[model samples]
Structure formats: structure tokens, C-alpha cells
Target: MSGAIEFWFDFSSSYAYFAAKRIDALGARVGRPVLWRPFMLGTAFRETGARGLSTTPLKKDYARHDWARLARAGGFDFRLPEGHPLIALAATRAFYAIDEDSPAEAARFARAVFERYYIEGLDTTSARAMGDFAAGLGLDGDRIAAACESAAIKDKARVMSESAVARGVFGSPWFFVDDEPFWGHDRMAMMEDWIRTGGW
Candidate 1:
């Protein structure tokens, strides 16, 4: 409660979508503010010489089943899109554009984007889709679209991705309670414990 929980996520990550749905309420319960950071997983992948789980053959198959199992356990609906592991640069950029001005508002926008991609199976990578989502949040859709292409916004996103890598973020759905780092959606309970007890 004394410090913020830094949440690092990639829009293309299904686990990140899972965490996004619940992080806010968890933070509120603990009297802590969550800092939602949307960064490109591709950048970290390049640094680590790794591909996404959905890109691996056997691992990909297991991931689908595991995601579904987790959804069932949590009592939420989850359907894998026709193509998994979507390219989400547009959605990430759009969130950053809104985040520069309002972090809370950006979090709301991120939830909408997550639902669009993970639930409704909509395209989160297209400028049009991102603009439409932003507009639905009462933001200026055209301006949001334009900002995605702006050098400043692009640089901001680049810096955030690099910073995340430099800070040892190797995967999506990572959280930092101060300098302590936790990874994966499955680690949320531990994260909440860390927040409540200040880590053991």
C-alpha cells in the first residue's frame, strides 16, 4: 500500500489479458495503486533468443489446453482465436498514447482492448480497431490513431520496452512490487501476499 505495483504486460499475451481482468480489484483491496505498463514482448524475445509459447509446437498445444483449464477454474469464458498470439503493436501504442496523459484512463482502455482481442476475437493490431476502441472510451479516435504513428509516441513505447528488458522483465504478466519481481498470471496470489505482507 505504501508503493505501487508495477505491472508489465504485452497486449499479445493471453496471460496478460487474464491478469488485467483482476489486477485492479486486487490493488484496490490492498490500498495500492497499480501501474499498468504495456510493452512489446517481441523486444524481450529478441533479447532472450526466444519465441512465444504459442509459436512452439508441443508447447503451443499445451498452452491452449492450460489456458482453457485456467479459465474453467476461474469460471471465465476463454476461446482461442482462429490465430493465437496476435500482433498487438497498434493496441500497445494506443494505450501508451492515452497513458502519457492518464494512467487510470489507459487502464480502462487496456481492459477494452484485452476483451476485444481475447474474448470478442477482434483485431487488436489494426489502427482502425485501436481507434474504434479508444473512441468507445470517449477519447478522440483520430488523435489516438495519429499518435500511434508519431515519433514521440513510438519512442516512448520503445523506451518502455527497453527499460522493461533492462529491469529483467523476461515475460508478460510480470509484476514489480518495488524491486521484487514476480512473473506469470499464476503468481497473482503471491503478488497479493507480497503486497500485503511486504514479502517474506
Candidate 2:
């Protein structure tokens, strides 16, 4: 009970998208609400000295086939976002830049970012797209630009990424229950089982 499950994710994570659809139900079974911690997996890689799946030719090939198979099986839509190595720095900042009174709005904006990249082929790094995305999220577009420029938000993003590494997370879609880290969207069943048995 003392340790909450942290969901460390980024916008471009395809598997993260898959997990997001299912994690809430798993958390509900455990009487725990998953804390959504958005962090840049790219940042985590840079800091932790871990290379992305693009490091090896074989790995990249496998990823393509895996995603295709998984996407088809799950009936999930597949579209590559406009920006692969996107700088989500500003977007992350915008969420933290908003005032406490606007938390719900901020969350909506964050969710939009995810949907933009994972579900839609929008370039999230584009200012115009971000402005529109913010507007769609029930936030004032003017305020979105200001939030994107906040130093505090950038710092928070960095801290969140570091925390993900500290928690032994080396990639996207990391889930934790108590001190146990579950890496990958496929491991959700394991987490669900653990939750059902009350610490099995």
C-alpha cells in the first residue's frame, strides 16, 4: 500500500499506447490508481547510457515485425508519427507550466500529446500542432506557449526521466507495483495476476 505503481511513459511509445488501454483496469483490481509519470525515453537513454532499439540492425528489423504482428492481433491502429526523434521538451513543460487550478486541463493536454503521436501522425514538436493540441485539450492557446517556455517544466521533465532510471527502468512503458518493476506492455498480465492474489 505504501508503494504506488508508477507508469513511466512517453508520447512516441507504441507499446505504451497498448498498456495505457489496459493498465487502468489492472490498477483498479488492486485498489490502486496508477500514477502517470510522463518521461522522455530518449532522455532516459541519454542519461542512463542506454541505446534505443535502433542500436542494432537486427533489433530494428525485429521491432518492425513485432509491431506489425502485435498491432494486427490487437486491432490497434498503426501510423508512424511525423517526428520519430522529436523534442517533446516544450510539450512536457506546458503541462507543468499551468497553475494548480488547471490540473485537469493540463492532464487533458498531456493525453492529447500521446494521442497525437501514437494514434495520429502529427508532429508533436511542431509549435502550430502543439497550439492546436492545447486548444483541443480545453486550455487557452496563449497560455500553452507560456507554459512551454517555463524553466520549471523543463527541470521537472528531467527529474522525472532521472527518476525512471533510478527505478530500474531502461525503456518505455515501465510499470511498477510496490518495488517490483514490470518492464514491457506484455508483462501487464503478470502484474494483473499479482494484483489479483494480493501480492502473489
Candidate 3:
């Protein structure tokens, strides 16, 4: 591979959680590093006029059912969270703050957040939840909790999200291998094929 795979994801996206669990191994197998990009989806939705699949009438019903099926197939233990979509702003800001100094730790924190939200059904939208997760990673919980509300961290998260939107990303679990774009966990096979065959 000539370049790393840019994995753009939102913490509230279950599909992104599935991808996050596997992207690193997939990238390693193909001799490429996965660049984890965490972004807030609220701005992306506003920019693209896109709504969540689970919020769209008939699609919402199917999505709830499909989420469980996909989770089972992917071997990811999932429970429908009490609050389906929690505001991801604080958690996202925390991610960017950690990512700025340590990408690896950021990845770990991201996965932990996903697991906490989906499997454990915790309300990870809270700054306290974010701080708890960060503390587990040996980070300063109070500092990170404070950072989540800081102007600098907030702006960083916004810029990262807006930059993704500017790059034509309007969905969760979106990936770019160099200039090639792929979307959704369902497209993982295609992405792997593209990596191996260098695209058609």
C-alpha cells in the first residue's frame, strides 16, 4: 500500500464501532496503518442534509432489527442503548484532545467508548463518562473532563468534522485509502479487495 487508510467515524455510530474493532488488523494485514479520524456527526448531518437511518420512518424500524442481525454476524455483543443517539460532542472533543498527543491511546479510548456505549449501554455522551474512560487508559481523568469543555478542544473537534465534510464525507464508518472512498461496514470486503488489487 502506498498510503494509510483514513477511517472516519463517529462515536455514536454502531457501524463505526464494528469497523473500529477490525480496521487495525485489516490495515496491518495489508501493510498499511489506519488513520483513525473521530468526528461529530451533528455538523456533518447539517452540512449534508442527511438523517440517521434509525430516524427515517420505515428505515428506522428496519434499522433497529438490522443492527442486531449485523451485530450477531459480526460477533459484536450489542444492546440497543436506552437513548439511541446521545450528543457526541463532549466525547468527540476528548478524542481529538487525546489524538493530538497520542494516536494509539486515542484509538484505544475510541474503542472503549464504543464498547461502553453499545455493549454496556452507558450514557457515554456525558463528560464524566468520557473522563471515566480516559482514566482507564491512564490519562488524567479530571484534566480530560475539563478539556472536553475547553474552547480549544471543542474547536479541534469542529475543524476535524468540518474538514471531513469538506472532503465529501457525510456518513459514519467512511474510509479513504489514498483518494479511494468506501462507506459502511458492509463495504469492508470491497475495501479489502481494493487494497489487494489496487482498485479496478
lDDT (CA) for every model shown? 0.87, 0.69, 0.85
Task: Sort the candidates on lDDT, descending order.
Answer: 1, 3, 2
lDDT of 2 by residue, 61-132 (tens): 787678777878888776655545466666666656653346546556666676667666666665456666
TM-score of 1: 0.95
Predicted model with the maximum lDDT = 1
Each model's TM-score? 0.95, 0.84, 0.95
| Model 3, global lDDT | 0.85
Give candidate 2's TM-score: 0.84
**Number of the candidate with higher lDDT, 1 or 2:** 1
lDDT of 3 by residue, 26-75 (tens): 99988899888888777789987889876789988887788888888878
Model 1, residue pairs in steric clash: none
Q: Residue 52 deviation, candidate 3, in Å?
A: 0.7
Pairs that collide, model 2: none
Q: Which stretches of candidate 2 lie over 4 Å from their true place?
A: 1-4, 98-107
**lDDT of each residue in 90-166, candidate 1, tens digit only:** 88889899988888889889888887777778787777778877888799899899999899888998999999999
Q: After superposition, how far is residue 46 of candidate 1 from its true place, in Å?
A: 0.5
Sort the candidates on TM-score, descending order: 1, 3, 2
